[model samples]
Target: MPRFAANLSMMFNEVPFLDRFASARAAGFEGVEFLFPYEFPADELRKRLNGEGLTQALFNLPPGDWAKGERGMASLPGRQQEFRDSVKKALDYAATLNCRLLHCMAGLVPAEVSLTTATSVYAANLAWAAEQAVPAGVKLVIEPINHRDMPGYFLNTQAQGADIIAAIGSDRIGLQFDVYHVQVTEGDITKRMERYMPVIAHMQIADVPARNEPGTGEIGWSYVFHRMDELNYQGWVGCEYRPAGDTVAGLSWRERFAR
Candidate 1:
């Protein structure tokens, strides 16, 4: 069976951020992931993981000014320096937390920035980031988010992420295949999963339309999970979805769909 990691940022919200680690452990998750770990000290976060005996599955490099709506700076033209700084900070935290996967968000492209320019900047930035991450034992990942959820986002297809990985060398970076985004942007999720499995380093899941637990929406969870196993995908699958009701109450999907 595929390993599932509770996304503490979305799951276990009933308690404090630090407390969610224990909650996730009690709920039977052996691994955990969150959006960002910059707010708290790395030692403190490491302490929580150690205390709960949880593996840090994945987390993102700092996106610039999240409150101001800047999703990420990797593809932004003028933010290259800031993006590099963000990467260094993230690597520091990853070393402390022993995290192997880091998702690099492709930010929304400004109207004035042509796709050509943005693509060039993004490629260069990722190449540089990948070079830095090699020594830290960290591999970077990029997710193609649906435009409906994140309009103007730079990357939006598995083909695009795969192409980027091909150009940058797969050893340094890989794809973060999120079922919710794939279903929203494009159908044929299984074919896409199979086609991209080789380059995929991490996975995330949520049902479409409502972005809730498995079996709560339109996705065929059994087939998806089965397909994952068949493909021999041995990476962490982050539960990056909002709960429909009580988080624990909604976790029955694991027994129902992930069996």
Candidate 2:
């Protein structure tokens, strides 16, 4: 079975991040992921993870101002310096936690920016970030968020993400394939996962139709999990879903995996 990691940012709402680490351990997760760790002291968070015996599987590099209409700009041209600076700080933070993956944000694709130029910038950014990440044994990951959930976001297709990875051609850089986003944007989860598995460094999941717990929505997670098993994918499979109600209240579905 694919190793499971709870997405602490979305699911552990009842407690602070550090406390949530303990909660995740108590809940039987071997690992956990989050959006941003910038808010807390990196050392303290690292201590918490070590104390809880949980691994930091994935987390995003800071993306500016979602509330103020600013999204990530790692792919936008003329911001190479800013992207480099961001990754440097992210590297420092990831080092504290002994993290192996950093999700490089694609941010919003400015209408004024041409797609070709954006792809070029994104490719360059990945190569640069990989240079920083590889030495620390960290894999820099690029994720494609769906347009429906994130309007104006760039890099929405698996083919596009794969092409960018191919262009960059680095073992340290790869796609952070979130099955929920790909299912919403591209549909064929199994075939797409199979097609991109070679370049995909990490994976996350949520049921479709409502972004709820697995088995509570339309996507056949059983088949998806079976496919991953068939492929012998030995990596973290993140439970990155929005809880339909209280997180613990909606956790009965986990019983299916218990057996």
Candidate 3:
């Protein structure tokens, strides 16, 4: 069976933290992912998840003061300490929540930084994260946001993400393949999925253009899901799209997956 997860950050925007898990479960998702989850107590979150029977498929390290426009600086030289600190905190949280994976945010890139420098920084940080995560039975996933959606972001391509994971060379270090980002950046979604499926640790989706529910945009989600099924992908397929109206109203297309 293909497990589906609702990204709380994208869906159920009106729900509170303590109640979001149930909302996601009520919305028919078997699991949930989030950008971050350090806002509340981990034990309490674990208890809530246990009660709701919702799995923590994915959650990210803090993006570091988004209000200051800091969209993560993990691969920057001077910010290494900040990146490690963020990872440490996230790992502690993941342990409490019994999460299987954690996304190590690769923040915005500086104009002066070379690609060599960025890749080296990311590889080094990921190698360290892999070392820390493997013992805890958690994988470290790095995402590639499309340039259009996140300009100057350090990691922005499936190939680039694969290279970074290859550099780290650990089972614990892998890619978070977001179909929405990859579709915007790379049009050949099926081929790219097939090519990187071996190294992809997580998957997320929405639609391009408006980033709404599946089937609302140019990407052929039916084909995409079919391809995923054909590949026998056992990981969670996360719904990481914005709701055009109310969350539930926008999720009616889920009936397509009822079979």
Question: Quick one: best lDDT, which candidate?
Answer: 1
Q: Which lDDT values do the candidates have, in the order given?
A: 0.96, 0.85, 0.85
Local accuracy of candidate 2 as per-residue lDDT tens digits, 164-256: 778777487788888899989989999998988999889998988788888788888767888988877778988999899888877777667
Candidate 3: worst-modelled 10 consecutive residues by lDDT: 250-259
Q: Which rank order by TM-score, best down to worst?
A: 1, 3, 2
TM-score of 3: 0.96
RMSD of 3: 1.4
Candidates 1 and 3 compared by lDDT, better number: 1
Cα RMSD (angstroms) for every candidate in the order listed: 0.5, 1.4, 1.4
Return model 1's CA RMSD, one decimal: 0.5
Q: State the lDDT of candidate 1 residue by residue for 1-259, as single tens digits.
A: 8999999999988999999999999999999999999999999999999999999999999999999999999999999999999999999999999999999988999999999999999999999999999998999999999989999999999999999999999999999999999999998999999999999999999998989989889999999999999999999999999999999999999998888
- Compare candidates 1 and 2 on TM-score and give the better one: 1
- TM-scores for every candidate against the unseen true structure: 0.99, 0.95, 0.96
Model 3, stretches more than 4 Å misplaced? none
lDDT per residue as tens, model 3, 22-120: 998888887998887887889998998898898999998888888887787678878878888888898899999999899888888789999789878
Checking candidate 1 for backbone clashes, the offending pairs are none
Q: Report how far residue 175 has shifted in candidate 3, in Å.
A: 1.2
After superposing candidate 1 on the true structure, give the runs of residues whose Cα lies further than 4 Å from its correct spot: none
